[model samples]
Target: MNLRRLKYFVKIVDIGSLTQAAEVLHIAQPALSQQVATLEGELDQQLLIRTKRGVTPTEAGKILYAHARAILRQCEQAQLAVVNAGQALNGQVSIGLAPGTAASSLTMPLLQTVREQLPEVLVYLHENSGSSLNDKVMHGQLDMAVLYDRAPTAGITSTMLLKEELYLIGAGDSPGHNVDLADVAQMNLFLPRDYSAVRKRVDEAFSLRRLSARIIGEIESISTLTAAVASGMGVTVLPESAARVLVSSTNAWMSRITSPTLNLPLSLNVSSRLPLSPSAQAVKNILLSLLSKPTIEDRELMLVG
Candidate 1:
């Protein structure tokens, strides 16, 4: 099967218009049409049916489309792997990260390392909640992601990077010290929006305690929520990594949440089925090494010390 023709066919079906696909592919519409036609001829079946509305894939077309997409993805991966093998630590790496996980202590150091060691590698960072990042990584949209260690998925591999403690953070003068879950429930809380692993855990803890916490705000960005907590708007529960950054910069104080010490397990998730590119593997190795570094834990301990 002609890979080019297969790709053209997939593009046409995706755009649902030969003209649109041609515009995207930067080829003449007639030429694009010919490619698709040739592919159908080679397959000995009608792959697409053109209607006044647009092009629609035939039943055979759908089957071919599925296989074609996978084949193209595999081919692209193969090319990336080959290029990466020849050029170690030189390539583009797209990493997805959960909201609070991208704070200074975690992602910044890794990015700095990439900048220094793999200067030729272009790094793209996408910030989302842990579940969203996990889905993106699983779908191959992300090379890897730092995510909360929830349950594992079938086609994704997760390696525990660290076990972090969650802290109750509030303004320095807020009427809180050695707070309990009940006291936390009484105060208005600022929290990350739903779908965040932190929010899910907080909700679960609240449910287990049969406590009704008043959530005053649901901010999507951890920075925004931290700012709110700093301003004495409300208290929030955050990973020690995030809380330490806030307390160090602003007049905020954080105490480890107890009654049940919230231990959030962080993980590095990568595609299990796809072989990682050498560059991606190199970045992953650096990240794993960083996670193993006693210095990281010592820094966290120093913050409390």
Candidate 2:
């Protein structure tokens, strides 16, 4: 449990010999052995089994080792962060953006702000399906992500940003005022595969209306999808903001989804499983604060579209 004991344990396991660990640690073999024994006692578990060559950790020891490594690394980072707190914030931040409306809204502002405020910090931006982003966030691979507000997952935290209404996107010549969900069954639709969050919701909405979407094509890339819609391959349903951005890209128009209007709340997701680095937390704060203000107005999105 003690930090020093954990270090001793990990060193011994790494070097495969108590004598070598003591040599590397500049401590006596007897002292190192005592520290490990004390650690095992505190946990009431057998941590190591003596081997002819040196030592090997028990199953419990492996678990402890993994956690101990992370803890020690975090502690070291905390110290460095304090030392550099007065200076420019410098750390790597990996953020995930759900393609379409999310990119048009959050990506530029975040990049511009971080460049101005934390020039020393490095940012990695990834755009993918909402479900993909959520998976990465849930696994701690991403520091934060933007996803739809859905039923809670175990290790991810969500803060609802805006309840965006759905819209029907089609070629510019296509005309419709308020399209009903059930009517989608009659039109050829281009949608992401079933794994995608948007497709899942779209399918559910149709099912609720006792209708099935006439899906003519499956495209994962948002760019390809917009091009397909522009060429009049088929129509797709999108959030109001996303619809605006997509329509602006090509000759397209949008009609609000009505008749049991569907509204999906966009949320900012962060991993609750691990403590975010100081830089990441700072970025997270900026994100939530910015989103708490008014969402992108229809006029603002006109530029991106």
Candidate 3:
């Protein structure tokens, strides 16, 4: 049961000689033999066969050797992980998430994960527009951001997290059926401001179809837009994650946009000009891991790919 005795037993079996193993381990031969004897006594197994040509393991000893190696390797890995985390995980990490996108849903999960995995790190979250979040990342105000990709920014690097298809959301008691792009263009639409990535994509899609989108309102606040759509104010275009949330929480329905489907690129943006701090990098790793392993609730909501 003793880790030290198990280690000694492993060394003796590996070298095929107690004397040589003791010498290599910086322990006396008699003491090393006593450790092995104690281990065998505890396990009630004849572990070693001592012969004139040094020693070899019994069947029992071979099994113990395999298990001991695994246990020791796991212990070493635990120690190293703790040491590395302690060295660089203490600090504040600032992260941004654009509202109305799937990234916004990750705010609570990221917080919970960072709290559980890296207790020493402090997290500061900001909810803003995609363009605004990207600007903050570029200026080093934010360690990283989850937002839609914009035109190539000079000092920003983006890693695509997911590509979400845009849907037309409207107020309805039942789920709406899929609608064509031309049908979407005919509806009164409430959308984000012109500067937003979503707005730009919607505009381009409409232009390509030679159809004009009737923009009755420009609503930037997600809550306001959701309320407007749910109140029968007008229909709006949004990606799957946001549309799902709005439809589930309110009297709304989401229909997929067909006939030249519009897709939005959700990405993790960081400053290309500056390296991330250790604490920030640790937080980033946690974020990526959480995204890669989506929860059942997230899958049900169709929040992330």
Candidate 4:
């Protein structure tokens, strides 16, 4: 029941040898063995099976190891929270984001707000696909992330920030301002790889229409896709938020897909089981507020409509 003994047992299992664990812990091998023995005596079970090569956990040991890992992680998180309390909002927060979608849409605004509100907090951003981001967040590697609603982990809670309308962006007037699936089927299109949520929706839309799109190129980044569309390479279906900045900068037109407007809801996901620090909570509040605010264009479109 001693936390220190449990720590020693974890180290032993991790290194697979008492000698290695002792060296890492900077203790004598005999002392490490005594600690493991004491733990085994307290638990009234053999935690490890020794072989010539190394030690392996028994069935009970595996269960104990699983619980012990969670305990140790919680303890470390507690220590970090205590240490961070004395300092000003000064701690490292690692955030994961979906590439090309969440980064341009919400990440920049959140970063700016975090910088202004919590100057002492260091923000580390990682960009990956939605599936990778979901995995990282569930495993506690990332504090939070903005991802599509398709992949939601069990322990994570999500709030729908906005539903972005997907637009068919093409060169030279967008082929009559509002094109149908029949119109898009005739033209060559550029799309992202299969892993993208947007691509999946595009495929579904095309399938529903009983049509096939002529895919000329597959690019990953929004910048590249915009450049391709601007240069008359091909047309693509992209979220309005993701394509808004690019279209504005390049003077390209974006019209909502008519046959079926593709709408992807962006969600802010955070681990409900983990305790959020005050600084992290503050940043989360700001982000939630930002999501509530309507963009100028959104207000204008509402008035016009």
Q: What is the lDDT of residue 141 in candidate 4?
A: 68
> Which has the greatest TM-score?
1
| Candidate 4 TM-score to native | 0.74
RMSD of 4: 5.4
What tens digits encode model 1's per-residue C-alpha lDDT throughout 1-305?
A: 78998889888887899888999999999988888878888889999999988899999998888677656767887877676675656767788877676233657788888888888888788987777776667555688888776777876898888788888888856445456777788888998877778888899888999999799999887668767987787888888777777787788888877787677888889877666767788788877877777666588888989
lDDT of 4 by residue, 7-99 (tens): 888888878998889999999999888888888888899999989998999998877875675566568678877887777776777777776
For all candidates in order, the CA lDDT equals 0.79, 0.79, 0.83, 0.79
Count clashing pairs, candidate 3. Answer: 0
RMSD of 1: 4.2
For residues 192-242, could you state the per-residue lDDT of candidate 2 as single tens digits?
788766777788888888887899999877789898998887999887878
Clashes found in each candidate (C-alpha, N, C closer than 3 A): 0, 1, 0, 0
Which candidate ranks first by lDDT, i.e. highest?
3
Misplaced by over 4 Å in model 3 are 1-88, 173-176, 297-305
Give the better candidate number (1 or 4) by TM-score. Answer: 1
Candidate 1 TM-score, true structure as reference: 0.79
Q: How many backbone clashes does candidate 4 have?
A: 0
Q: Summing lDDT over every window of 10 consecutive residues in candidate 4, give the lowest-scoring window.
A: 98-107
Clashes of 1: 0
**How displaced is residue 209 in candidate 3, in Å?**
0.7
Order of candidates by TM-score, top first? 1, 4, 2, 3
